[model samples]
Target: MKKKVQILSILFLGISQVAFSQIKEEKLILDRKREPEVKKIEKKKTSVTAEKNYPPKEKKTQDSLNLKYNITDVPAASDFKTSTIQGEDISPKFNADYQNNYFQLGMGNFGKILADGNISTTLENQIEVGADLHFLSTNGLKKEYNWDSSQSSANIGAYLNAFGEKGKFNINADFGLNDYNYYGIYALTPAADIDLQQKTNRFKVNGYYDFYSNNILNDVRLKSSILTDKFDAKEAQAELLVNLSKHGVEIPMDEVTMNADLGINLETINSEFSLLNDNTSNYFNATLSPKLTFFKGKSYLMVGSGFSFLNGKNNSNLLTEEAKNNKTYWFPKAEVQIAAADEFKFYGGVDGGLKLNSYANLLEENPYLVSDQELRPTETKYKFYFGIRGDVDQSIKYDVSAGFAKMNDILFFKANSLFNNDFSLNRSPYNFANTFSAAYDNGTVSEVKGSIQYFPLANLVLDGELSFAKYNLDNNENIYNKPLVVASLGGKYSLLGKKLNLGAKAIFSTDKTTNSFSFTEAGTTPNVYLETEDKNDKIGGFADLNLSAEYKVHKNFSIFALGNNLLNTNYQTFKGYKVLGAQFLGGVKISF
Candidate 1:
């Protein structure tokens, strides 16, 4: 029993040892698994401490990001105050000064006088109102010259504007009185006592409405006007125009736009003299244009087309076959633009339209026109042009172009032929009347033109333009009154903070040809009669120079002097009428 007990104890001891070894192995495995967790805790604590010392970057505001230079070192302001930031003031500067009223008066050689006044102010409801008056008179160079003229005009206008909105309404009214004499006959009959006086009174009213929205009907406009003039002749015209447009029509890589215009015009004219005829005219026009623009690259092309319908009628005794009927036309519109570089661009286009000539319109362009005249519309079939226009530098710009145009029924002016009859009551060979009659010439005209503008200094600017034209008439008729070459140069300089301003302008024109009429005796002694003969008269070219200077005496007052025709040129814009010579005028301008 003692031997068995010893053996049992040994076995029990072996079993105990094996169990202890297994238990130890399990604990070792658990410790290996927990080692990574202890290292992670230590790393997390180190990360937290580092983050507390140095915070992460915060997102920047839009305003701060837009700044070109760094301003992170700037100190926070303790109190609100006006101060400079980087040599620029960050405060609002308000000026409550208003100067919208002015008056000027002056007199010069040849009994010339000028008076002008203007006043403008802002009213309630965002309304702006203004009025202006002007008066001018000149006794001319000499009594024998018969070039006396005088004019007076006034205008009143108002505008109602919606700020931060999309609408506007405006209206204006004008009245004018002009007086002049028929002095162009002096060259034909030097000693003729010509006392023909001409006077004209004009009245006009114009108004317009514009609105914009965000629908298919994006924009709309309505314009209307009434014009009337009375002289030896009476004329009246009324016009109305309506326009509608749409925008923001998106296409692939482009935007498309469309516009439509409808218009109506009516004119009536009458003459008191029995020689001139009376007439009434009406015109209706409508057009639709669609345009496309691409905005994907440096080069772009705009394609558009205009479909127009024109209807016209005239009730008169002297109406031409074309003018007395209705017509329809089509106009093409297109343009191309390419940006070659940062400061260089190339552009070109083709466009055409119809233009109406009325009695009131003719008189405004040439006041010496005869009352007995025929009116018509000019139709431009096509006008093609190509050019380059861009800035050479920050201080200079240039535009050069070449073009060709085809026109139908273009008008030219020529002196009236002398009547040759002794027994005829209206037969005065030298009637002491110089009348310009309109003549039509169907033709094509080609032209080249260029202009340049330079700013050598901030306060000084110089500009010039030159043009050349060639006309090919279908009927071989002379292109009367049209200059082949024309050029102009002008400059303005300001000194002493614009307290003193100086300006100079010069114009040059090439000679042109016109037809002149003269009377000659014909037949034998017993049967003596007068015959009219035609001669070509060459109007000489001329250069006109004008200068002006103004000095400010006060903030609201200025003294100025002007010199016109400084070269004393004996040039005649008309066939026989000579312009004024050298003259000086001084005046004071007051602003309030």
Candidate 2:
């Protein structure tokens, strides 16, 4: 029994030893597998250790091998430094600057003086105010006239503009003073001892309103003027004009634009002539015009009519019978335009109107006029015209037209040889046959005219016009002081980066005819006279050339020069008055 027990014990001892060895190997394998996982957890914990404050971790050890492991905490990183990027500042540049004010002064031969200035400013509330002054004077051409032929003119004006949301209003007032001397004489002799100095004063006020409210009411204008001359010739005029229009209305078909327009004009003129024993002439005119236009594909047709009512009273003995009539005028205003091609067009029209002739208007046409003159209204009975217009190219355009007109009471300027027929030096003033008087005649006129414009470059422009006319007068032998042929050519060019500008113009006019009357004392009476002969005096044609130049020293400063009548021809602008041979003016301009 003892021996059996010993064998079992030996077997148990061997089995126990084998089991312990197997367990030890398994523990080593488990530790190797957990090492990687433990390292990963330690790295994750170390990353967050700087952000959080944690208590110390417990140490771990293997029982049989007595192995230990430890983990260390990490330190926080230093604060990072931040900065911003910076760049250089830049400003805008421009080639030129705009100015709102200008001033100019000049002097030339013939004792000429000129001055012009303007100032404008914009205040708050869309309001603008401006003022301007202009003056020109000449001390006379002593060589041409034995007496003083000096002339002077001065003007001062102010304007105000108020802009609204949908409209604008403008008001302007101006005053003018003109001093002139009439030194015209007949070819045979000089006579009359009249007051040579004539002074004229003018004052005017103009008001305009333009609407942009997208309605039928378009614009309105009111103008008034007062004029007084040295001879006690006074005139007062007032005019009112109103325009109404509506566009984009379909009349006959779709996509066709129809426009309706109406215009009304009212004017009154009053005059008093001291030379005619305070003879007073008063006139009032009212005109109403209405038009309708239809536009379709670059072609348009307009049909309209005008009605005019005229009433006047004249107590002047010179205009007694003709001025005592009241008349009503009917005018036709019609036009048709057809586009034949992209570049060509055909047009026809008929128009007529009444032209008011006043003392002020006659003075403007011929300054050396007698104060006691006949005043009448010109009636354009009918004017019919047909024309062809086209564009030659993108840079050129042309227009040609032919027209025929019948007119009544057309005014003509004729020499008034009041006291010069006998060459009397001690006669009344303004009797040297140098002054002009109004002559009326019924006439028919036929004319052909053409115009062309060329714009080859942005800074260059050229234009030309030519016209020929034939006049047949009923009561006059020939058309007085009217040109049969007229032509003009003009051009402007800029060079040197737009710093230099040059311009030129040429004008040519055909000869004019003026009637010369001779009287012979036939009766035995002291003042009785009989007309002997009436002859036509011919005034030769003339050509005028003008040149101008301007050089910009700076953007705000410039020097200019003008050469007028460059041909130096001694030409007569009127029947007896001759213009200066050549004129030169140089000056500098400044702007701010």
**Evaluated with TM-score, which candidate comes out highest?**
2
Listed in order, each prediction's TM-score against the native is 0.74, 0.79
- Runs in model 1 lying further than 4 Å from the true structure: 1-99, 143-164, 190-193, 212-232, 248-250, 254-274, 278-280, 295-299, 318-323, 419-433, 522-535
lDDT of 2 by residue, 1-592 (tens): 3353354345434533443343222321222212211111111010111112111121111111111111111111111000000000000001122234777777777676767777787789867788877787776556766765678888888888776665667888889887876666644344333456667899988988766532578789998999998888889999999988776666768657777889999999988888843567788999999998887765788899999999988776554353465889999999988878535888899999998888888876677787776677889999999888765444556678999999999888887766434423555446655678888999999999988765445445556779999989897779788889988666555566767766656667888888665555555655544444345788877766666677789978888776666566666656667766667777887877
lDDT tens per residue, model 1, 126-211:
56677656666666546445333323333333333332244445566666666666566642443434354566676766666544
Clashes of each: 0, 1
Clashing pairs in 2: 194-429
Q: Give the candidate number with the greatest lDDT.
A: 2
lDDT of 1: 0.54
lDDT, model 1, position 284: 59
- What TM-score would you give candidate 2 relative to the actual structure? 0.79
Stretch of 10 with least lDDT, candidate 2: 82-91
